[model samples]
Target: MSFVSEFRSFIAKGNVVDLAVGIIIGGAFTGIVNSLVNDVVMPVVSVVVGGIDFSNYFFPLNSAVTATTLDAAKEQGAVFAYGKFLTVIINFLILAWIIFLMVKGVNKLRAAEEKKPVEAAPAPPPADIALLSEIRDLLKNR
Candidate 1:
């Protein structure tokens, strides 16, 4: 097949389409999670922890370059931005927890569906067996 045809065939697959949809949804979900962490969770946490911004927490490696914020420190010299790492870790934990709850709920729904009793249609007897049974019944009546 030609390159364009091969590419078209690959993109036409169900799994590939599902994966693309998943990626788009995941990106949107990430934005929501980020907003939840930054706007809601962080503010509440900051209040509880004396209103300290974790992004501003960093250690300057160079004595000559003294900066308050992580960005400023980077402009001057090398600095260990542990605070940003901590914030990222917190975001990841929250996202993971939300995903876990979603998966758990989906699993519960699936389990409920599985537990439902399925009423199957009764099978018909073979023609020969049915005829023999009918003859036996007639003989018994006689």
Candidate 2:
């Protein structure tokens, strides 16, 4: 087969298509999780921690770096941005928790499905077999 045709066949496979769809969805989900962390959860956490913006919290490596915000600190000199790291850690934890819950729910559903009893209905005999049985019964009656 031609290279183009082989590539086309590979792309047409179910697993490849499913992986592509999963990547697209995962990207969108990452955006939502980022928003949840940056906007909603972080804001509440900020309120609890005396309204300090964690993004702005950092330790300047240089004495000349006197800027308050993380951006300005980076502009002046190198600094340890532990606050941003903390925020990212929190984000990862939340995402992991959500994924864990989703997995747990799916497992529960699978368990429930497994618990269901499957009844197999008996199949009818073929026409010739049925006729032969009927003839044998008639002869027995005689």
Q: Give each prediction's root-mean-square deviation over alpha carbons.
A: 7.0, 6.0
Residue 117 Cα positional deviation in candidate 2, in Å, after optimal superposition: 2.5
Model 2, runs deviating above 4 Å:
1-6, 126-142
**How displaced is residue 19 in candidate 2, in Å?**
2.3
> Which pairs clash in model 1?
none
Worst lDDT run of 10 residues, candidate 2, spans 115-124
Q: Write the per-residue lDDT of candidate 2 for residues 1-142, one digit (tens) a residue.
A: 9999999999999999999997998889889999999999999999998998898879999899999899999999999999999889998999899889998999999999999999878898999999999999999999
Clashing residue pairs in candidate 2, if any?
none
lDDT of 1 by residue, 34-53 (tens): 88888888888888999998
